[model samples]
Target chain A: MAGEASSGTFLQGLERGLAVIRAFSAQAPSLTLSEVARDVGLTPATARRILLTLEQLGYVRTDGRQFSLTPRVLALGWAYLSSLDLGELAGPYMEELSAATRESCSIATLDLPDIVYVARVPTSRIMTVALGVGARLPAYPTSMGRVLLAGLSSSELDVYLANMQTEQLTPRTVTSASLLRAAVDQARADGYALVDQELELGLRSLAAPIYNSRGRVVAALNVSAHASRSTPESLCEEVLPHVLCAADHITTALKHRGHL
Target chain B: MAGEASSGTFLQGLERGLAVIRAFSAQAPSLTLSEVARDVGLTPATARRILLTLEQLGYVRTDGRQFSLTPRVLALGWAYLSSLDLGELAGPYMEELSAATRESCSIATLDLPDIVYVARVPTSRIMTVALGVGARLPAYPTSMGRVLLAGLSSSELDVYLANMQTEQLTPRTVTSASLLRAAVDQARADGYALVDQELELGLRSLAAPIYNSRGRVVAALNVSAHASRSTPESLCEEVLPHVLCAADHITTALKHRGHL
Candidate 1:
């Protein structure tokens, strides 16, 4: 897109190559040359060349006709994780909390209308959709998302709400902008958030803000469980204290390490 | 490097762009334009364009002059992790083993002479260097590395041995090729590998091979602890059984999913 605006400086080939890599997702883990070309808007011959180059670099592998990303591609994401040091700083606390709660604990940072999980420690499989590090969830329906959304400035939150596609992911999902805004305001006042069966049936999560050394809310930490396992009142009474404490511990650790 | 040989088919700009991203590391998390250009072996003008493109794509962030990757880059690795499904399949078992043994547990796959961690559940920080998913360690001195290396065919092992740079990471590290070969042979015969203070002075680890449905060794799972906390006999008697059991559970799960 930048290439269209400034063709002289931008490297469109680089953009196209990354798009090719991204075209392979959970829905389509592997694809043929033509599929890749069509998915990324490249010619078949160009896609073949890029695939060949990626294969040569060990980022991709080919089973003659189909191409898929290799484990080596994980290094691309590793570069960012290692630099962020989020896992290293927050992992032990999340692990302890998950162990204590017998549920999934995760850390996520705001990425506009979506919150992307950066680190997760799972105790059991609770949701139909498998959630892991880097999974994105809408800010309006999830506890972590709401806490992160609550951290944003009013104007930033307004802009996010203006462009947000408020779909009803589940019957409990808040589709009204005003209701969502009130939820976010409540999260800010409470210093934590609780979402019960909003993202999916039988799922509930509680989240608390994680602050950096500068006292800025940089991420949100959550504990998630099945609604059958945890009622909203129980989540607040049992899980909220642990989640808040773990979030505070991580914040303190980050501050001690001068990561803020 | 492949671009140098096959310039016609390779998108050198893509290669350069990735190199630029990889230029940021734990030691240098943030870089100026000139620093990035110098590290990636590109001109300032070219590096600026790539950085601008990445920034626009939300993969990189800039603070006036300095640039660093954003958490969105984790999605690139998530694509591979979610597709591989290794973490999802292996995580709960790793957590159980870690909890039972009170030691760190990890799963790693061989990548030439290095072993890349695919999944990890750590109980406590024992090593000087942080080891997480996607962290790479030389195969010669680590227990997981040895287990993975032992899984290779004789010819493949020979090729790896020939290319390996056998550095003396610690006083306990085996530097002789024949000695390392004997260690690999022992691992093959024992069905597990144990290394004490080899990779790091205070670290002890034991690893077992995890096989796919086809009975091919696909990965190695290990339990690690401080040498002060675990002796060789303790590792053999206490840690080995849990590590082997966890690996078997993961292998069986993989088989059930028909992933092998």
Candidate 2:
């Protein structure tokens, strides 16, 4: 169920093997052969074959009887790091923004209805939130992703709205497509987005988009904090300016590097 | 050439696919078909085939015919995040340490001769070092890894030392085995490690191991800053105590969770 079914013989073995590797993460960095089998929904025999395969390839290592991930797994993340023009160019500006506000800040891109964090600087980690690099949150609910989506073409927005499977993450989560669209429109007009206890309870965030030289938003940058620390009004009044400034700085950096 | 020769019979195709995926990063999130091929030293046709396969697998997406990574890539790192009991358990403590020192902090596990960062709370990216959640650094040179290595058994340390290929990242890098072994021994005796201008010229870091209830060091924690900001004296005097305190707090948390 995790992968698309390809017509004819299109690397089923490779797909299964890759799924096994992907099965290991910060959450499940080590597993017994059977745990991996259940996680990837493959048979135990198949999982063992894949794990053995991965071990032989040096992407994984076994300790006596227990299995653990190897540092070689990092090569996958490094590939994306080595090739992304936006993430690299945004570094100095992200640091500047983090320094300017002394708050946790991040850059994320919209992966359709979800926002995947591509970069982050954690000034603090709220006990309830797991907001780290490579973390994901629903796009319709997160400030950064919504801001990025605000720049989408109307048709693209419509597609997202149509396909969105809304689940109320918290009391503030807007499950109605119309409400979400209105929020996106407001974000476009104001050039920023604010989410107040929508994605997670007691978390508030403000975001602004980083535009390429082509004027298309390639990413979004934001500052996030506890709702107790960031009232909606104060965020809009105090933090919004800094978020917008950071976005502009990132935009300028991107343009200077011709990444637009 | 980067992999063991016998690996081809195992998950080599998946490894190559991961290599293709790893080729993209915050620095290079997107790559032309030919550029990816060139960077990975794969034939253009082979790279194209792999990219097509990755696209089908939802790992990569095309933004107007140019290949860009999707949030799905985070799934790989997420596996590590979700699997590692140590990282999740260490989160709150890391944040506290980051706040206390007002500097970046991270936890790493020794991956033989290298250390792979498992959990981190980066305060800022002032020096343009864009290390991410799954980043790798030389174990002998990084404070966290050295601290972790200091806790290793003699045989384990011998194997690690025997296999180390110390590339001089900076002029200050420790290349001699005896010097590196002495540093490890000192760390074992003092219960902390200090690294200055070794990995990055301006960076200074201090680390301490986090022991579980079993009194075994499972991970290493460190606080890093610019040399101008945290001199060797300041790091040992000011930073080491705080790092050790945070490490103890994290160990208690891990014990409470019954993960120790």
Candidate 3:
């Protein structure tokens, strides 16, 4: 899209159909026909056609008025997750990190304004929101997101910040683009990002990047805990080293597997 | 498809596009242009259009000759997994079962001739084949498959059997349709299924059905182990009780969550 010619070959029907699927998020799992249309910015008739197509394909299920997705949808993702091998590759290191820190460890990559968790190892601390695989968090406020942001090229980072919609999730959340840019720069310089009580009131986490064989940052690994579990200084002193080591181990594993 | 009238407004483009996405699987993660066209039963020109659209949309990536799926495809599955809430609901139960048996615990539902793993709590035993979430296995030989197949109505099960292409994965795998039917009935009668060295030479597992509040069996939960760890007799004598209890707990949780 940035440089290539997409007009002659682009498939609008495919795009619209996928957009309709995207309209349903964790916050709004099920949506009425009109809601889907509105969310995807399509007409009612167009939305209905796409929804009906998806329903016919067993990807979407409708119960009279509202429509939701089915487990069959996972078949679409199985190809990607299995091929990427991130979850299987990162699982052991994450579990060890979780055990050592007595907290959850997650691996995530950037997905625009949000960071999507690709894998996780939990210490059984159930939070208000269930942060499982494929869970997303705003990139501006999360340690993993900041590390991922730091991995981006300067121009790409500038473009993301320009389009980012920052929310004041906590009192410490930095909403200004200039400050967020500076934080990303600091993360790049320090080789890690420590976010304290920014994403949530009682959350403290630090993250480091996982590189591929080519030495490009492919994902971020983070150890997340309750603020009461450790102060920011103690987290840096105690957990940051483990976080960095685990991330590097994952990177080395990726290289050993010949993934660039 | 059995009874519904799908005349006009089926959106063939959407259908074909999704078919292209489904062409990639764990065994065949990447495909060339002609391979995609041949596998998907689409003309090379049409397949090229869909592939280009997916590439621009960030779901597919190609390196000159071979095209593979990207993690962005996980977004499509995220909607369904999160909405179903099974992974979150079944997580704690699966962990407990895995801990108790010192083996991997998984939950799966029927998807035609296959059972797709929806949730799993794994032990750190790296196998030749990595079994993680979204992994699919032939339904004829797995304990979970038998349990789920038993849950289907007689007519539905018959239809599935008629279409199912059973392969003798191991010497112990039952390939006869009548024998498979008998096995499913036995599972239904006993409220559990134990598959011994059927899926693989050294793998053994026993599964129990997880029912919704409406008493409809929605998923099957299983504890899978190596034959060295447990004999068929010991698995039934020592591990069957925990597997049944854990699956029942998941059903209760689903009921509490008002899934049905």
1 or 2, which is superior by lDDT?
Answer: 1
Q: For residues B1-260, what per-residue lDDT tens digits would candidate 3 score against the true structure?
A: 11112247676767777888888875677899999999988878778988998999988888878898876787888777776678777887887888888888888877777888878776753321256667788999999999999999999999988888988899999999899999999999999999999999999999999998889888999998899888999999889999999988999998897753
lDDT of 2 by residue, B2-77 (tens): 2212233454456567777777765666789988889888877667767887788877888645787766766665
lDDT, residue A170, candidate 3: 91
- Judge the docking of candidate 3 as incorrect, acceptable, medium or high: acceptable
Interface RMSD of each: 6.3, 7.5, 7.9
Per-residue lDDT of model 1, residues B1-260, tens digit only = 21122357777777777788788777677889999989888778878988998988888889778898887787777787677777777877887888899887788887776788877765753221266677888889999889888888999989888888988889999988899999999999999999989999999989999997878788899988888898999889888888889888988998997742
lDDT of 1 by residue, A1-260 (tens): 21122356666667777888888876787889999999988878778878987888888888698788877777788788777787777877887898888888888887776888877776743221266567887778999899888888899989887788988888889988889899999999999999989889999999999998778788999998888898999998898899999999999998897743
How far residue A170's Cα lies from its native spot in candidate 3, in Å, is 2.0
**lDDT for position B214 in model 2:** 86
**DockQ agreement of candidate 3 with the native complex:** 0.35
Q: Please say which candidate is ahead in lDDT: 2 or 3.
A: 3
TM-score of the first chain in candidate 1 relative to the native first chain: 0.89
Q: On a 0 to 100 scale, what is the lDDT of residue A6 in model 3? A: 27
Q: Residue A186 deviation, candidate 1, in Å? A: 3.4
Per-residue lDDT over A100-166 for candidate 2, one digit per residue giving the tens place of the 0 to 100 score: 7778888887767688777776663442236656667889889997898898999999999999999
